[model samples]
Target: VTSMHSLLQSATFLPQLGHNPLASGPLVLTKDGHIRGVSGDKAHIFYGIPYADPPVGAYRWKAPRALSPWPGVYDASFPRAACMQACAGPIIEECPQTVSEDCLHLNIFVPLEVNFSTPLLSSLPVLVWIHGGDFIAGSASKPLYDGRFISNFTRTVVVNLEYRLVVIILLSFSAVNKSSDM
Candidate 1:
């Protein structure tokens, strides 16, 4: 059994004794737009950054389209909703309560020691994590996949991405079948 203390300690989302991101979040400008993220003791965490436009309406069952540059700073302090999926058994606890079709976002974790303002002398290794749920139910937002611990310990940049899951896949198959029958 995991103790609450240990769970809290392991949680990368919880801010530690260092920088207070609430007062002034760390800002990073990306092609899509500027993002503001939170800073923990060991890592600077950017959460729920959309890589593509929301897959809805005509966009559904199609390849994800590139996102347009947002007019203002995108607040990335909180994790976004998980892709629509049914949660069951013990795995349910690990899943986000809210789910949606517009969930193709990624979280980035950078070691706090790396100064983003200055040019890096050397490039840090990157670790991209795709959550496992047999291509169905897991989410990058799950606390189990939080990358702060790994980023700080290994001095590497970590990224966790969300992808369309079971329902979307099934719908796509159904659409294909229907179109062929037409």
Candidate 2:
């Protein structure tokens, strides 16, 4: 997996890390569909994690759609794909995305101190952040506004979500999805 910067939009970044992350033991990070990385007691931080369909082609500049649920625990060792927008620098294609009719996804920033086995605290709240690239440009997946800061600052969950907020095209998304069937 690779980590890179994203363009095309501005995202709200909320740090989720606590001050004493080093006090914990190592943690696991997942991505795609496998166990990816292990962090030292220093803390395991995953960022720009993708949780949906890529915003490419017909899905470009459109509303976000439902995401494909992952089977195994995702190894969020690295960041996921950022939205597609015009940029003027060395772009990293690591999180390559194709324009398609399916383009709804979310990213997460979770703390290492917490895990499934950990007790659930009703006081904990999750903050889901929506980006403002409008349509055609902008991605919550951008690297700069990622998990490191949040996982180190707060105990809450920070999610960078990508959704469709675009000017309606002449044809509806139904037609777009149909075309892909062929």
Candidate 3:
């Protein structure tokens, strides 16, 4: 579970990995933060990082906007909530505690460090994620759906995106596509 292999081995093809003597053993850190490092690269990991702003109150039934950035490191140990939808059906409930209209948010996972000083290639590759369904039925907060696994394995950033549900009007007998009145 704690292997240092890149998440996207298909892309980077890290020749330095695979039982190499230089790449062996977990990294040891310095108390002074100067990094008494080795010849190879650093191990990377990502946890739960909030991808969307909380969809509460006025955010109900509206497009998901931007999230307020944090000053220091933030904890992403939780899942995004299902939008103002029932576990099924429809009813006149303003907002539920577990599910709400303000439930548009996503999460990401990325390694903390990369070989940023490489002369030929100075940065890590970008990975974007579109979650669950094709914009029909899915929440970014589902269990095991987190990108942390990808981030840890690939040692790169992984983003999980969530879009709002389509607006449909139902009149018992038939279904109708409604405009963006919300």
Candidate 4:
């Protein structure tokens, strides 16, 4: 039997000729171009996709900017850092310990059957999940929020976005001043 990795590497996510409908492969595309993602029997996983620019430096206190267009296909094969937050004692390990202002990333889980040729009406429904952290802690990257199970069962697209919580709230006032100065 061919190994799953080889199968994934060789196949593209589409059902077009030269591709296998059942094979897991790199086959998703964003407006920026192609994105390398992983596929399961029922779902295609694309993680760490940046929906906005990092809110660092001058942008810290301002509204999110559009993600600058990248020159080539982005590798959405891995998870990105979660937003900055104080660790919750014993629960710290569960947190994506690494923190950054550039944590405005998201994950996408697409059912294998949903493809470019799928009609809008026949297209899979989408589920946008906002993780529960009391608006202070949780992240979309958390294990508790993994979208694979739901995507498979519902045959839908699941998108989970990570965003700054406490930091953004605290900077609201400062952002106003910074913007006025610009």
Against the true structure, whose TM-score is highest?
1
Put the candidates in lDDT order, highest first. Answer: 1, 4, 2, 3
Candidates ranked by TM-score, best first?
1, 4, 2, 3
The list of candidate 2 runs beyond 4 A from truth reads: 1-73, 86-103, 165-182
Per-residue accuracy of model 4 over 12-80 as CA lDDT, tens digit each: 333331222453455544444555677766677788877776778977777777766566767877778
Residue pairs in candidate 3 whose N, alpha carbon or C atoms collide under 3 angstroms: 6-153, 6-154, 7-153, 7-154, 48-76, 51-106, 52-106, 55-102, 84-100
Could you say which candidate leads in lDDT? 1
Better of 1 and 4 by lDDT: 1
> What C-alpha lDDT do the candidate models reach, one value each?
0.75, 0.44, 0.39, 0.66
In model 3, the number of clashes is 9
Q: Please give each candidate's TM-score.
A: 0.82, 0.48, 0.45, 0.76
- Report RMSD (Å) for each prediction in the order shown: 9.1, 9.6, 12.0, 8.4
How do the residues 83-131 of candidate 3 rate in per-residue lDDT, one tens digit apiece?
5443344423322236544454444444434432322243445576666
List runs of model 1 lying over 4 Å from the truth. Answer: 1-23, 180-182
Error at 6, model 2, angstroms: 26
lDDT of 4 at 25: 54
Model 3 residue 19 lDDT score = 20
lDDT, candidate 2, 49-162, per-residue tens: 454445466665354443443576555455454444443345434323543234344555555555433444543445666665435455665554565467546876556655
